[model samples]
Structures are given as structure tokens and as C-alpha cells.
Target: MHEVSICEALLDQLTSLAAQQGWPRLRRVWVRLGLLSGVVPDALEFAFAAMATGTPAEGAELLLENEPGHFDCAVCGELELERMDFTCPQCGGALQLLRAGRDLWLSGVEPMPS
Candidate 1:
């Protein structure tokens, strides 16, 4: 699954970050997952846990935060999507994506206790 590759990339990023920041290890990792990211949370967690073995991030807590999908309607301004529908309720027009629910990124990290 691509989740394995995703975890591998994440570990690489964590390793680089720890080196750049001079941190001994990472205790936690916070990832922001969008509703449309297509990445499974359970799969990501399982992959990360497995891939983190013997690494600096081993035993680190992987926390996921959901980013709600937002859309912009020509006649309705910005609004949160409802039921994953792309139609505007007020104007019956197409809704364009504005923000959220389209990306997967690391938001924060906690360094291991000294």
C-alpha cells in the first residue's frame, strides 16, 4: 500500500527535522489529515508504528487531526461542505474548493524529554 511509502517519507522528514533542530528524539508527531486526502488513518498509524522501529521516532505518538472540507460558492461565499455534496444549497451552483480537506501534512512535533 502507498501508506507504507507515506510512512517512510514521514520518518525521513522526522529524522531530518530532529537533526536540524538538534533534538535527541521525537516523542510525538501531529499530522493534519484532510477529508479528501484519501489516506486511511488506521493504515497510516499502523504503517508508522511498524516503520518507526529502531528509529529516532520509535514509540512516538502519532496524532491525527481532521481538517474539514471547505468550499466556496459563487453566490454563497465560503461554507463547509455538507455530506460531501459539491452543489451549493443557496444558489444551486457548483461549489469550488477553498481550503481544508485536500492535503496531508505534518503540523507539529514534540521532542522527547531530556
Candidate 2:
């Protein structure tokens, strides 16, 4: 799945970062996952565990933070959620999608001492 490729890319980045910082190992990898992102958390986790084997980040914990989707309604003057077709609930006007939840990134990492 795409998560496997995502994991591969992530490990590659981590390896480069670890080498640059002289970090012995990674204790945790914190990432923020957008709700609209099609990547599955469980699948990503599994991929990370499998891909990290034998690497410095082998035993590292992959933590995910989920973000929700949001839309802005011009008539409402603020962001809204829980509406289908992206139409304003009050004014029936078309709503603008502010966040589509497409994000996969590393937010933080705990590096083990050398």
C-alpha cells in the first residue's frame, strides 16, 4: 500500500537526520495525520515496524495525531464541519474547503543519546 512507500520515505529521512545529529537511536516519532488523508494509521504503524527492523529506529514508537477536516462558509463567516456537499447549512451557499486533511509529516522525534 501507499503506507509502505510512506514508511520507506520516512525511514530514509530519519536515517539521514539521525546521522546528521549523531543520534544513537530513535525513541519516538511523532506525526500529525490529516483526517482526509487516505493513509490508514494501523497500516502505517505496521509498515513502520516492519521497515524499521535492523535500523537505528528499529524499536522507535510511531505516534500519530489525527486532524479533522474543515470548511469555510462565506455566509456563516467561520469554519464549519459535519455538512454534506460542502453547502452552507444556514444560507445554502457553496462552502469553501479550508482543510482537506492531506498531510503526512514528521512533527517531532525523541532521539536516544549516543
Candidate 3:
């Protein structure tokens, strides 16, 4: 799945960071995932484990923090908490996604020196 590609990308980033800092190993990785980011946590974990084999992050723990989606209504000037779709419940107006839940970010990383 796409999670595999995502995991590979994450590992690349981690490796680059570790190299930049002259770190020998990665201990943990904290990721911020949007709720509507269309990524399954379990799947991502699996992908990470699979891709990390023999890598610096082989046993690194992947911590995920979820962020909810938010929308703003143009007609009513109301900000709405959106769990799924882009419809404003308060004013029945077309909602504009202020922050669409489509972020996969590396928040922090713990590295171990050689």
C-alpha cells in the first residue's frame, strides 16, 4: 500500500537527520498524523517495521499524534469542527476546509550516538 512508500520516505528523512547530527542509531520517532490524513495507524506501523529491517531505526518506536480536521463557513463566518465531510452544520453553507486532515509530519526524533 501507500503506507509502505510513506514509511520509506520517513526512514529516508530520519536517516538524513541522523547523519547530519552524526548519530549512530534512532531510538524513537514521533509523528503527527491528521485524523483525515487517510492513513491507517496500524498499517503505517506495520510498514515502518517492515521497512526498518536492518536500518538504524530497526527497533525504533513510532509514536503517532492525531490532529482533527477543521472547517470555516464563508457565509456564516463560523468555524466548525469537522470529523469527516466539508459541510457546515450550523449555517448549512458550503464549508471551506481551513485545515484539511492531510498532514503526515515528523514532530521529533530521538537518536543514539555510536
For residues 26-75, what per-residue lDDT tens digits would candidate 3 score against the true structure?
98889988766788899999999888887778889999887766677887
Q: How many residue pairs clash in each candidate?
A: 0, 0, 0
Q: Which clashing pairs does model 1 show?
A: none
- In order of appearance, the predictions have TM-scores of 0.77, 0.76, 0.74
Candidate numbers, best TM-score first, in rank order: 1, 2, 3
The lDDT, on a scale of 0 to 1, for candidate 3 is 0.82
Q: Tell me each candidate's RMSD, in Å, in order.
A: 3.2, 3.6, 3.4
Q: Would you list the clashing residue pairs of candidate 2?
A: none
Instruction: State the lDDT of candidate 2 residue by residue for 22-106, as single tens digits.
Output: 8879999998777667788999999999899977789999999876567778768666463234787678888878866676788
Best candidate according to lDDT: 1
- Residue-level lDDT of model 1, residues 1-114, one tens digit each, is 978888998999999999899988899999988778788899999999999987789999999988778889988899885236678877899988776666688999999989
What C-alpha lDDT do the candidate models reach, one value each?
0.86, 0.82, 0.82
Predicted structure 1, TM vs. truth: 0.77
| lDDT (C-alpha) at residue 27 in model 2 | 95
